[model samples]
Target: MFERFSDDERAIEGLPVRLVIALVVGIASLSVMMNTIGGLTALGVTELDVKPQPEVVAEGSNEITVTVITPEGEPVANATVVAKDGTATLSQIRPAKTGPDGKATLSLSPSLGPNQAEGTITLDVKPPAGGGYTDDRENTKLLVVSGGAQSS
Candidate 1:
């Protein structure tokens, strides 16, 4: 003989536990995926190129032109360009903003150690705000030779 169960004994209460767990897991996964995509979109979308008029300079004052462009080589205007000392000693470099031509001229004074033969000055750029541009690529370097000698 089999015993019959009552309706109250078989009825489930509130939300199904499996459904609640699935909803929480789905929401968490969606949040993580969205964050990952957003972070990826914020990187390496732009490039910065530098052309030191002479490509090489003496141990004193120098001028360098920085160009902000996209991966397609299209110019990006209003970007800010910054300079930093690499293996060379340099005077404080003032940041410059690019014009409509995507060019910013920076004045820098690069110097070398008394015994160092040559060094390099590094350049970086920050694309205009809200343009979804990133300055994560290697820009360019300026060569500084000793004794006021320029590289051929």
Candidate 2:
């Protein structure tokens, strides 16, 4: 009985079926893009940077400091700093928080592992939760020499 309503009547009341569907599809596409971008940002898609200077130092005599920052030169604070020789030497520095200058220091070990006394080590800096920064590690020639009395 309702087959009498013509397409003109439906168009007069609102948009045509195709136009309505297009509007809904456009809105849904926009929403999907926004959500995708938000998810990527939350996943820490950005890569951070870590620079260590004076890569070499005398064990138990000096400390190796690493500066953490973003590609845009922004300082990253409240992150975890870890140093390792890629073997058995590892140090989880305390007060790992980066200062206003985005610098964190870790002491070198004087006690070498087995027959080794001094070598290179890699630095890993991870941003604090919800800190809006990504994790980074040293992939360059960052090394420190350890040859002195072990410091407490």
Candidate 3:
């Protein structure tokens, strides 16, 4: 076999590895400093300058029952209901779907006070994207979770 190329001075190459390392380290250090400054700024800063006032709801006692009604003023069957309050919060509050009368009643055991208790019950629906069904609770109003109530 051949004895290989003579003392190969042209076989080696230089890449300035120090420059590459310095560039990478400089980028990393800049990122870390930016993250630290951002974290410090967010520690005590509020997102909004003016805090909106919450709606004043009536005081409620233990075990507050809720009935979910659909957009057409009809009760939504098999709809999930959630009830939350200041002291304690409940999830999947009740099971019993709507009956033939399209009415589902959800009762919260040992409820909470009027300290801004808000509950959101969502239902899953198919999206137009042709994908699997998506959550459509935001678009539907099964149960009213806001200030004031409709007088029957």
lDDT of model 2 at position 129: 74
TM per candidate comes to 0.75, 0.52, 0.28
Q: Lowest-scoring 10 consecutive residues by lDDT in candidate 1?
A: 1-10
Question: 40-91 in candidate 3: lDDT tens per residue?
Answer: 6434322211100122222232232334444335433444443333333343
* Whole-model lDDT per candidate: 0.78, 0.62, 0.38
What is the lDDT for 52 in model 3?
8
Candidate 2 per-residue lDDT over residues 1-152, each given as its tens digit? 45665633655555577789999999999999999888775364556777666655554435767777777767677766666565435454333556768888766552347677665566677777766667643444355444543322
Ranking by lDDT: 1, 2, 3
Better of 1 and 2 by lDDT: 1
Q: Pick the candidate with the highest TM-score.
A: 1
List ranges where model 1 is wrong by over 4 Å: 1-15, 43-45
Error of 1 at 133 (Å): 2.5
Clashes of each: 0, 2, 0
Whichever of 1 and 2 has more TM-score, that candidate is 1
User: In candidate 2, where is summed lDDT lowest over 10 consecutive residues?
Assistant: 143-152
Candidate 2, residue 125: CA error in Å?
1.4
